[model samples]
Target: MTRTKLLAKIRQVFPGHDPEDVQRVLDEYAGPERLRVHLAILKLCDEDRRDSPRHYVDSACQDHRDVLAWAESPQQLRPDWFSLSVTERAKVAKADRQQYARWLAR
Candidate 1:
């Protein structure tokens, strides 16, 4: 999404707050994670059609929930994935891949 659209969505999600400050926090803390979380929220809220197939949107929603569960769990030894830098997010994604592989093997 464009910066303006993202800022507007952030404002809508967090009303009565400064949009500039919200943008700064999102840029610094959430980064790409913002898109996943926001998309999941939008899908669940369903104020508009997301222009994606229902299955694709459902998968995104599930992935977002998994990320949230991981972030909230003590097993997530590193920083919260949402707050991590791009490099850190990559590392976490790698670890998650391995974990999923192991789960599948069981």
Candidate 2:
């Protein structure tokens, strides 16, 4: 539901997940997208045999990097862009605009 509540759930599900990684995702994505990413990561924990949750955060951030790269250079499309979840795509679209603004201001 809320970001705070979502963070609590993530920490509970993957106690080993880094708090900073979780916070970065929360700050980078909006409410709905954040929830989707959380759910996706939780699902990964279910299917993955790995003892670490660190990579889950990496997966969540992958789309962010892809989006940023595309926004910085839209002529080159990311091959894996289509593989991202709808929520991730939408959030990145929104974030890309903000990122451009920040870049432009600099």
Clash count, one per candidate: 0, 0
Candidate 1 structure quality by residue, lDDT tens digits, 1-106: 4666555665554466676764443343343466644433433333343322244334444565553343233234555656888887777677766753442233
Model 2: residue 87 alpha-carbon error in angstroms: 28
**Clash pairs of candidate 2?**
none
Which window of 10 residues has the lowest lDDT sum in candidate 2? 67-76
lDDT of each: 0.47, 0.54
Q: Which regions of candidate 2 deviate over 4 angstroms?
A: 25-32, 49-106
The digit string of per-residue lDDT tens for model 2 on 6-47 reads 566556555777856756654555334656555445444534
Q: Write down the TM-score of every candidate.
A: 0.31, 0.35
TM-score of 1: 0.31
RMSD, each candidate, Å?
14.5, 12.6
Instruction: Give residue 30's error in model 2 in angstroms.
Output: 7.1
**For model 2, what is the error of residue 69's alpha carbon versus the real structure, in angstroms, after optimal superposition?**
24
Q: For model 2, state the Cα shift of residue 22 in Å.
A: 3.5
